[model samples]
Target chain A: MSQFLDISGLNARIDADGQEKEILRGVDLVIPPGEVHAIMGPNGSGKSTLSYVLAGREDYEVTSGSVSFQGKDLLEMEPEERAAAGLFLAFQSPVELPGVNNANFLRTAVNAVRRARGQEELDAVNFLKTVRAAAKELGMSPDMLKRNVNVGFSGGEKKRNEVLQMTLLQPSFAILDETDSGLDVDALRIVAEGVKRLRSPQFSALVITHHQRLLEYIVPDRIHVMAKGRIIHSGGPELAQQIDREGYTKFLAEAA
Target chain B: MSAPLAVTLEPFRKQLEGVSGQPQKTALEALHHTGLPDRRVEDWKYTSLRFLAGSVFHKPGKNYDSAKARAALAALGLAEGAVAELPRLVFVNGHFVADLSVTKGLFACSFYTADKAEPGSLVRSDREPLAALNTVLAENGVVISVPEGIDAGQVLLVSLGQADSDAVSYHPRHSVHVAKGGKLSLLSVQAGEGHYLHNPVTEVFVAAEAELRHVTLQAESDAAANLSTLYAQIEERGNYDSFVVGIGAALSRHEVHACLAESFAQVHINGVQRLAQTQHGDITSVITHAAPDCISRQTVRNVLDDRARGVFQGKVLVEQIAQKTDGYQMNQALLLSGQAEIDAKPQLEIYADDVKCSHGATVGALDDDQLFYMRSRGVPEGEARQILIDAFLEEVLELIGDETAREVCKTVIARRFPVSEEGA
Candidate 1:
């Protein structure tokens, strides 16, 4: 396989005041199948920008680069198409859809993906049963399923809801962008557990975080250090500990 | 009393001139005094019935093939009418269709055939010229009366318009009265085909301690015009609750004039209108708190697509003597197309010092963030848009206390939306 996810010479810019400002400068990275990779970076290091680009957010312009998922061009697909193609992005802050029933929203997403993947659609009763079970495993209340999607949900609840969606979608590759932020320790552990449960030879993940706090619960196979819109270092899990102990001072000095 | 008549309105004036009864003459005189309200008139500023001046609507004599009428009736999903278990009183083109009708609670043949005109017990005609015109022309209608201290289960009235090549108009005058401590729930469904104008003026009376739940739906053919008006009067401790749904017609307006005539009476005017394409809809209400401690509430929602336009003009009048009055009204519109338009006017005329009255109107397009969120979740843009629109309408539906009636309201709203599904 030509690199499960191949990103080469990725150059991106964001629009600010009718002007394009470079964010990602000639960055290159790759994640093979079944490997969990963590990208640890400080603020303004373009960690979030990379996740947003991979998720196909329209605000950012990709000046130059090629992204391949399973040998298929990923840049040409819409956000929903990317989702249907097994690319899921766990948002740091889940959107609140007032008046949209949580169960209804979840069912619509599930059925849509199933139809795209040619899987048999689940009926309402079966859907409820499955969702109830999954929700219980995540320590969620039945009322959460009855309320509107993410409306008035607490910070922890929103994070857990994101995890619930990831578990339900079961994407081949997931980009968890700071899902550990705004989450309590217990919630962080539970969310990490949810991601760990999906670990398999067929699944891989790109976890982006500013702190190494999340890597503690879900150990990563590889750790990458990013600074000033570029990955400056790559090593084993020990790199996470090193960064936690010394901070990005040494890395920034070296990159400069 | 006729206002200056245009060339088109002369015929109505002549027709009114021929009728001599005081009520009919008074109505005709008023029509003559006001002629047909044009742009100059305050109430008729947004909607112009000026076409009715030039247009001639033939009497309901052109009977069509029963099959088309049956199809129109079937498509209405009358089973969702809530009171489906109750026998339905069917009216076709302002004339009762006995073959397809069975009525319970209270029914009178005179109201259907115009064979007689009994003195109307509850007449609170507003100053609108259309109200006066309806008085002179109204012949087909229904009259229901509940005895004192009795609870009548429910009653349904269905009016179907059979398509005809020639344009026509008819006024169905419905009069209902609930005596002291009486209860009544009335469901009215108005649907039709072809180029026609359905003007229905329903007058309801609720005695002290009585309650009336009135739900009216106007889903006429896209080619037709519907101008429906409701007049309600409430006494001490009486409640007049109503919900009106406007979904069809090229030009339509659901107008209401409710007066709380006694202390402690309450009135609720909640409704929803969905219009698409070149259609135009208006929901106008004028509620008056004439007694102390009376309350009134109004909530209306509109979903517009294409070049469709919706108008809301609601006014709450708290009389100087009516202290402790509580009145509230809110109107919201969702524009689904760039060309769609909504005009909202909330007028609050409160004279009481110790009263609580509030009114608000909002107009906006589909939220961009909400749309992106749903689409990001894998819902196609069209379906996601439909979901948000549906959700936006639920807040108004929740105001409906009757479960079955709420379902009926939602069903009508849904059937009217996704307009492409119907045209395609």
Candidate 2:
């Protein structure tokens, strides 16, 4: 049928100081419903830039591109509008909103997204129950809900919070950027298991990372190697093993 | 000193000549000497009464209809909810309306200066020309004193500056005393209608080991001017907790002078002043650590909209005998519009060697990153801005020690901001 997320000839650049530096150059990607993809790249590669572009963060000029989410123009939406359209971006470093209670922030967001989808909003009690269960499953303490969002949280706790939000929002499409970098082995497993639970006929994810360890827990169906602002190679899960064994030296040389 | 000032003072001078207390005569004499503080005075540096200088504001000889007074209280929405049950002392246009107040069995007003008695100790008249005017022309006031070893219930003081007359001024003097081992909670609200000038003075005396909680909310009209002064002196082991929330008024200032006179005395002054559309608001406080082993904390927040201006001038004075004193003061502002302005001045004058005193001030717009973070989480842009603005001011509100008054402050603040989800 139709592609779930279609990114075709996506070229993006950020204005730094006085010059426009290209970050994502003619990148093309497509995933049907229910498929998970991993983007493995070295530092200075355009992996994180791609995730930001999809999220519609300001200051990035999409020189030439098209990102179609569920057959709609995703690039034309506001960040919140994008969120309302079942598109979620789990930030590499989840933002800390000081003075905003974790629970209140999530509830406001959940209600916003829910209303946009023509769904009735959850009451406080029901929202609490859902959040509590999800937080318990993610091994996050209930007090995390009482404190300010992501403020004073440990590195692992912030990552777990991202997964917690992902579980709560129940997005049809998610982009996890380096979500496992600060997490420990146990925390990584919990986060990966949380993501794995969302794998269904309608759910899809693009996990962006540098290491292959996270890929072991929630194994992706496809792994893409990116270098020098472009995804230069694509292969099956076996390709991830090859990169883990040899590193991105092969892709870096070829892309140059 | 000048012919114009004397002419403007002639009407008030004639009104004061009708009263006959020694304190009134002395204060009136001082009023003639200083003649309504102007821009030149250091204490009134940022605030200028030059506009008021031209207007001949007659003393409030206006009558108070209990119906109108009650309606004003009801409009505050305070009487509709939790504050309804509070036994309040209602003053309308500088006159106390006995019919609108509940003053019989719950708590007694020790001194009703309405009947031309009880001077309320005009302590700051020498330093403050406004206090001089208050002592000379104050028509009515409430002085509630709790005896030693008593736990008196809280009392509400509601002052409405609404009157039918043109450009009237009222000076209502209030004095509260908590004797040794006594405790008291006082919630004071000052609101007005139309163009008027409200100059109310308050003097609080906290005896050794006593406690007092004072919450003042000021919401005057855009055509009005308000200059309220509070002078508090605390004894050894006494505790003073005070919070002020100001909104509205074309020009308003709340001047506080707190003296921790004895050892182990504590004082807290936490306040918020909000203004919109060319309105000007000020929170000026001077705290003194006169004795050793005392502590004082002052935190104030200002949220200005449109072309509004906010001024925060706070000073902490520590005497040589005030060793081991601890003092902290912070004033922060959030300007929602580009045209909004804030002037902050924090000063410390300390003679003690073993004291820890610090002060800080910050002026900024609503943080862009915080706003974007909330918006990205699916909160609408308007709602996101409202949330961040509330959070910025909530930092000061949360510092209030009393729960009920803090909630009232929060409700008032939320209702004033249109985009707030809580009040919306």
DockQ scores for all the models shown? 0.65, 0.62
lDDT of 1 by residue, B356-402 (tens): 99888888988866766666666666777788888888878787777
- CA error at residue B352 for candidate 2, angstroms: 1.1
> Per-residue alpha-carbon lDDT of model 1 for A129-157, expressed as tens digits?
98998998888999999999999999889
Look at candidate 1 and give me any clashing residue pairs.
Answer: B1-B33, B2-B32, B2-B33, B3-B32, B3-B33, B3-B34
Residue B185, candidate 1: Cα error in Å is 1.5
Which TM-score value belongs to model 1? Answer: 0.93
* Winner by lDDT: 2
Best by DockQ: 1
Error of 1 at A12 (Å): 4.2
* Runs in model 1 lying further than 4 Å from the true structure: A12-25, A227-229, B1-5, B8-17, B50-54, B62-64, B79-83, B105-126, B418-424
lDDT of each: 0.82, 0.84
The TM-score values for the models, in the order shown, are: 0.93, 0.93
The true-versus-predicted C-alpha distance at residue B49 of model 1, in Å, is 3.1
